[model samples]
Target: MKTFVLTALFVTIAGLSGCDRSSQGFSLPQGNAELGEQVFVKYQCLSCHTMAGYETDTENLPGSMETPVALGGQVSRIRTYPELVTSVINPSHRLAEGYEAESDQSVMPSFNDVMTVTELVNLVYFLEDHYELEPYPRTDYVSPH
Candidate 1:
Protein backbone atom coordinates (compact mmCIF):
# COMPACT_ATOMS: atom_id res chain seq x y z
CA MET A 1 0.00 0.00 0.00
CA LYS A 2 2.86 2.41 0.86
CA THR A 3 4.66 1.63 -2.42
CA PHE A 4 1.54 2.21 -4.46
CA VAL A 5 0.93 5.59 -2.83
CA LEU A 6 4.52 6.69 -3.47
CA THR A 7 4.32 5.67 -7.13
CA ALA A 8 1.06 7.56 -7.59
CA LEU A 9 2.51 10.67 -5.98
CA PHE A 10 5.56 10.51 -8.23
CA VAL A 11 3.41 10.17 -11.36
CA THR A 12 1.28 13.12 -10.32
CA ILE A 13 4.31 15.34 -9.81
CA ALA A 14 5.80 14.32 -13.14
CA GLY A 15 2.58 15.04 -14.99
CA LEU A 16 2.24 18.47 -13.41
CA SER A 17 5.83 19.37 -14.23
CA GLY A 18 5.26 18.45 -17.88
CA CYS A 19 2.23 20.72 -18.00
CA ASP A 20 4.26 23.64 -16.61
CA ARG A 21 6.93 23.13 -19.27
CA SER A 22 4.47 23.61 -22.13
CA SER A 23 3.39 26.98 -20.71
CA GLN A 24 6.98 28.26 -20.28
CA GLY A 25 6.89 30.34 -23.52
CA PHE A 26 9.80 28.50 -25.01
CA SER A 27 9.84 28.86 -28.79
CA LEU A 28 12.58 29.19 -31.40
CA PRO A 29 12.47 31.98 -33.96
CA GLN A 30 12.23 31.15 -37.66
CA GLY A 31 15.87 30.73 -38.74
CA ASN A 32 17.64 32.33 -41.68
CA ALA A 33 20.36 30.23 -43.30
CA GLU A 34 22.35 33.27 -44.43
CA LEU A 35 22.44 34.75 -40.95
CA GLY A 36 23.23 31.33 -39.57
CA GLU A 37 26.30 31.04 -41.79
CA GLN A 38 27.48 34.40 -40.51
CA VAL A 39 26.90 33.19 -36.95
CA PHE A 40 28.88 30.03 -37.69
CA VAL A 41 31.78 32.08 -38.96
CA LYS A 42 31.52 34.67 -36.18
CA TYR A 43 31.72 31.82 -33.67
CA GLN A 44 34.64 30.22 -35.53
CA CYS A 45 32.92 26.83 -35.74
CA LEU A 46 34.85 25.90 -38.87
CA SER A 47 38.02 25.81 -36.81
CA CYS A 48 36.84 22.56 -35.21
CA HIS A 49 34.09 21.16 -37.40
CA THR A 50 34.23 20.39 -41.12
CA MET A 51 31.02 21.29 -42.96
CA ALA A 52 30.58 19.75 -46.35
CA GLY A 53 31.12 22.20 -49.23
CA TYR A 54 31.54 25.13 -46.89
CA GLU A 55 34.92 26.84 -46.86
CA THR A 56 36.41 29.12 -44.28
CA ASP A 57 39.31 31.56 -44.38
CA THR A 58 40.02 31.02 -40.70
CA GLU A 59 42.77 28.52 -40.02
CA ASN A 60 42.91 26.07 -37.14
CA LEU A 61 45.15 26.96 -34.24
CA PRO A 62 48.48 25.26 -33.79
CA GLY A 63 48.32 21.69 -32.39
CA SER A 64 44.68 21.45 -33.45
CA MET A 65 43.91 18.44 -35.61
CA GLU A 66 43.55 19.09 -39.33
CA THR A 67 40.32 17.14 -39.35
CA PRO A 68 37.90 17.32 -36.49
CA VAL A 69 34.25 16.30 -36.35
CA ALA A 70 32.68 16.24 -39.78
CA LEU A 71 29.21 17.75 -40.01
CA GLY A 72 26.88 18.06 -43.03
CA GLY A 73 27.19 15.79 -46.11
CA GLN A 74 25.65 12.36 -46.46
CA VAL A 75 24.77 10.91 -43.08
CA SER A 76 23.70 7.37 -42.33
CA ARG A 77 20.99 8.93 -40.22
CA ILE A 78 19.66 12.47 -39.95
CA ARG A 79 20.19 14.47 -36.81
CA THR A 80 17.09 16.32 -35.65
CA TYR A 81 16.92 19.97 -34.59
CA PRO A 82 16.78 19.13 -30.91
CA GLU A 83 19.83 16.92 -31.26
CA LEU A 84 21.78 19.78 -32.83
CA VAL A 85 20.70 22.19 -30.10
CA THR A 86 21.68 19.72 -27.41
CA SER A 87 25.04 19.19 -29.06
CA VAL A 88 25.79 22.92 -28.97
CA ILE A 89 24.40 23.51 -25.50
CA ASN A 90 25.69 20.28 -23.99
CA PRO A 91 28.42 18.84 -26.14
CA SER A 92 29.38 16.03 -23.79
CA HIS A 93 25.83 14.74 -23.51
CA ARG A 94 26.52 12.19 -26.24
CA LEU A 95 29.81 11.26 -27.86
CA ALA A 96 30.06 9.80 -31.30
CA GLU A 97 31.39 6.26 -31.62
CA GLY A 98 35.22 5.95 -32.01
CA TYR A 99 35.55 9.54 -30.74
CA GLU A 100 35.64 8.64 -27.07
CA ALA A 101 38.83 8.98 -25.07
CA GLU A 102 39.87 8.14 -21.52
CA SER A 103 37.49 10.82 -20.30
CA ASP A 104 33.85 11.02 -21.36
CA GLN A 105 33.98 14.86 -21.55
CA SER A 106 33.71 16.52 -24.93
CA VAL A 107 36.61 18.43 -26.48
CA MET A 108 34.13 20.89 -27.98
CA PRO A 109 33.34 23.77 -25.69
CA SER A 110 29.72 24.47 -24.76
CA PHE A 111 28.25 27.39 -26.70
CA ASN A 112 25.50 27.93 -24.16
CA ASP A 113 27.30 30.94 -22.77
CA VAL A 114 28.49 32.48 -26.01
CA MET A 115 25.60 32.15 -28.44
CA THR A 116 22.22 33.84 -28.32
CA VAL A 117 19.05 31.77 -28.59
CA THR A 118 18.37 33.11 -32.09
CA GLU A 119 21.88 32.23 -33.24
CA LEU A 120 21.51 28.71 -31.92
CA VAL A 121 18.19 28.27 -33.66
CA ASN A 122 19.60 29.59 -36.92
CA LEU A 123 22.69 27.42 -36.70
CA VAL A 124 20.59 24.32 -36.24
CA TYR A 125 18.52 25.25 -39.24
CA PHE A 126 21.60 25.80 -41.38
CA LEU A 127 23.09 22.47 -40.36
CA GLU A 128 19.88 20.55 -40.87
CA ASP A 129 19.71 21.76 -44.46
CA HIS A 130 23.10 20.23 -45.29
CA TYR A 131 22.39 16.61 -44.40
CA GLU A 132 21.54 14.22 -47.24
CA LEU A 133 20.09 10.73 -46.99
CA GLU A 134 22.74 8.20 -47.89
CA PRO A 135 23.05 4.47 -47.35
CA TYR A 136 25.79 3.26 -45.05
CA PRO A 137 28.51 1.22 -46.72
CA ARG A 138 29.00 -2.41 -45.73
CA THR A 139 32.44 -3.40 -44.62
CA ASP A 140 34.22 -6.23 -42.82
CA TYR A 141 37.10 -5.58 -40.50
CA VAL A 142 39.87 -7.97 -39.41
CA SER A 143 41.54 -7.46 -36.04
CA PRO A 144 45.23 -6.71 -36.39
CA HIS A 145 47.44 -7.94 -33.58
Candidate 2:
Protein backbone atom coordinates (compact mmCIF):
# COMPACT_ATOMS: atom_id res chain seq x y z
CA MET A 1 0.00 0.00 0.00
CA LYS A 2 2.83 2.38 0.92
CA THR A 3 4.77 1.46 -2.27
CA PHE A 4 1.72 2.09 -4.44
CA VAL A 5 1.20 5.50 -2.87
CA LEU A 6 4.82 6.47 -3.46
CA THR A 7 4.71 5.28 -7.07
CA ALA A 8 1.61 7.34 -7.79
CA LEU A 9 3.18 10.39 -6.19
CA PHE A 10 6.31 10.05 -8.31
CA VAL A 11 4.31 9.76 -11.50
CA THR A 12 2.29 12.86 -10.67
CA ILE A 13 5.43 14.84 -9.85
CA ALA A 14 7.08 13.98 -13.17
CA GLY A 15 3.98 15.01 -15.11
CA LEU A 16 3.71 18.37 -13.35
CA SER A 17 7.45 19.13 -13.45
CA GLY A 18 7.68 20.26 -17.04
CA CYS A 19 5.34 22.38 -19.16
CA ASP A 20 4.17 19.82 -21.76
CA ARG A 21 7.68 18.41 -22.11
CA SER A 22 8.13 14.88 -20.97
CA SER A 23 10.48 12.80 -23.12
CA GLN A 24 9.07 9.30 -23.67
CA GLY A 25 11.96 7.90 -21.61
CA PHE A 26 14.75 7.74 -24.22
CA SER A 27 17.98 9.48 -25.21
CA LEU A 28 20.01 10.04 -28.37
CA PRO A 29 23.70 9.79 -29.25
CA GLN A 30 26.25 12.35 -28.07
CA GLY A 31 26.19 15.31 -30.48
CA ASN A 32 28.73 17.72 -31.95
CA ALA A 33 27.65 21.37 -31.59
CA GLU A 34 29.74 22.35 -34.61
CA LEU A 35 28.01 19.77 -36.83
CA GLY A 36 24.71 20.88 -35.33
CA GLU A 37 25.42 24.44 -36.44
CA GLN A 38 25.87 23.16 -39.99
CA VAL A 39 22.56 21.32 -39.70
CA PHE A 40 20.86 24.53 -38.50
CA VAL A 41 22.14 26.38 -41.54
CA LYS A 42 21.30 23.51 -43.90
CA TYR A 43 17.69 23.53 -42.74
CA GLN A 44 17.50 27.31 -43.22
CA CYS A 45 16.05 27.81 -39.72
CA LEU A 46 17.10 31.45 -39.73
CA SER A 47 14.55 32.09 -42.46
CA CYS A 48 11.88 32.51 -39.77
CA HIS A 49 13.90 32.90 -36.60
CA THR A 50 16.64 35.15 -35.29
CA MET A 51 19.72 34.11 -33.33
CA ALA A 52 22.86 35.98 -32.43
CA GLY A 53 25.94 35.26 -34.56
CA TYR A 54 23.76 33.77 -37.32
CA GLU A 55 22.31 35.42 -40.38
CA THR A 56 19.29 34.71 -42.57
CA ASP A 57 19.50 35.15 -46.34
CA THR A 58 16.27 37.12 -46.70
CA GLU A 59 16.70 37.45 -50.47
CA ASN A 60 16.72 33.67 -51.09
CA LEU A 61 14.14 32.51 -48.54
CA PRO A 62 11.52 30.03 -49.75
CA GLY A 63 9.00 32.19 -47.94
CA SER A 64 9.17 34.71 -45.11
CA MET A 65 7.35 34.80 -41.79
CA GLU A 66 5.18 37.79 -41.00
CA THR A 67 6.99 37.89 -37.63
CA PRO A 68 10.33 36.33 -36.79
CA VAL A 69 10.64 34.14 -33.69
CA ALA A 70 13.64 34.96 -31.54
CA LEU A 71 15.81 32.12 -30.35
CA GLY A 72 18.57 31.86 -27.69
CA GLY A 73 19.18 34.88 -25.54
CA GLN A 74 19.06 35.63 -21.81
CA VAL A 75 16.46 33.35 -20.22
CA SER A 76 15.04 33.36 -16.68
CA ARG A 77 14.24 29.65 -16.77
CA ILE A 78 16.67 26.94 -17.78
CA ARG A 79 15.76 25.20 -21.03
CA THR A 80 16.32 21.50 -20.54
CA TYR A 81 17.49 18.96 -23.15
CA PRO A 82 14.16 17.12 -23.35
CA GLU A 83 12.29 20.41 -23.70
CA LEU A 84 14.50 21.46 -26.58
CA VAL A 85 14.05 18.09 -28.31
CA THR A 86 10.27 18.33 -28.00
CA SER A 87 10.35 21.92 -29.30
CA VAL A 88 12.08 20.80 -32.50
CA ILE A 89 10.18 17.58 -33.17
CA ASN A 90 6.66 18.52 -32.11
CA PRO A 91 6.60 22.26 -32.55
CA SER A 92 2.82 22.58 -32.33
CA HIS A 93 2.64 20.84 -28.96
CA ARG A 94 3.01 24.24 -27.33
CA LEU A 95 2.91 27.47 -29.26
CA ALA A 96 5.19 30.34 -28.33
CA GLU A 97 3.42 33.16 -26.43
CA GLY A 98 2.27 35.49 -29.20
CA TYR A 99 1.81 32.70 -31.78
CA GLU A 100 -0.87 30.79 -29.87
CA ALA A 101 -3.80 32.67 -31.45
CA GLU A 102 -2.61 32.23 -35.05
CA SER A 103 -4.87 30.43 -37.53
CA ASP A 104 -1.93 28.30 -38.66
CA GLN A 105 -1.14 25.44 -36.28
CA SER A 106 2.56 26.04 -36.49
CA VAL A 107 4.82 28.06 -38.77
CA MET A 108 7.65 25.54 -38.34
CA PRO A 109 7.29 22.63 -40.72
CA SER A 110 7.72 19.03 -39.69
CA PHE A 111 11.37 18.03 -40.03
CA ASN A 112 10.86 14.57 -38.52
CA ASP A 113 10.56 12.95 -41.95
CA VAL A 114 13.40 14.84 -43.63
CA MET A 115 15.84 15.30 -40.72
CA THR A 116 17.91 12.35 -39.56
CA VAL A 117 17.83 11.51 -35.85
CA THR A 118 21.52 12.29 -35.63
CA GLU A 119 20.96 15.74 -37.13
CA LEU A 120 18.23 16.38 -34.58
CA VAL A 121 20.56 15.42 -31.77
CA ASN A 122 23.33 17.56 -33.20
CA LEU A 123 21.07 20.54 -33.77
CA VAL A 124 20.01 20.40 -30.12
CA TYR A 125 23.64 20.56 -29.08
CA PHE A 126 24.18 23.61 -31.28
CA LEU A 127 21.07 25.43 -30.03
CA GLU A 128 22.04 24.73 -26.42
CA ASP A 129 25.13 26.87 -26.91
CA HIS A 130 23.17 29.99 -27.79
CA TYR A 131 20.99 29.93 -24.65
CA GLU A 132 22.29 32.09 -21.83
CA LEU A 133 20.55 31.28 -18.56
CA GLU A 134 20.45 34.06 -16.02
CA PRO A 135 21.73 33.10 -12.60
CA TYR A 136 19.30 33.10 -9.71
CA PRO A 137 19.85 33.86 -6.02
CA ARG A 138 21.05 30.91 -3.97
CA THR A 139 19.10 29.97 -0.87
CA ASP A 140 21.06 29.88 2.35
CA TYR A 141 19.95 26.88 4.32
CA VAL A 142 19.59 27.09 8.08
CA SER A 143 20.98 23.96 9.74
CA PRO A 144 18.91 22.82 12.69
CA HIS A 145 20.98 21.60 15.61
Give the Cα lDDT of each candidate.
Answer: 0.72, 0.78
Writing each residue's lDDT as its tens digit, candidate 1 over 2-70 gives 999977865665565433322333334457777888888888888777787777434673243445678
Q: Which residue pairs clash in candidate 2?
A: none
Best by lDDT: 2
How many backbone overlaps does candidate 2 show? 0
Worst 10 residues of 2 by lDDT: 18-27
lDDT of 2 by residue, 1-145 (tens): 9999977876675666453333646445567899999999999898878898878655544343556787898787767777889999999888876665457467688899999999998999798778988787567899898
- TM-score of each predicted structure versus truth: 0.66, 0.68
Name the TM-score of candidate 1.
Answer: 0.66
Kindly report which residue stretches of model 2 are placed more than 4 angstroms away from their true locations once superposed.
Answer: 1-25, 58-64, 101-104, 137-145
Using alpha carbons, what is the TM-score of model 2? 0.68
lDDT of 1 at 14: 50
Q: CA shift at 55, candidate 2, in angstroms?
A: 1.3
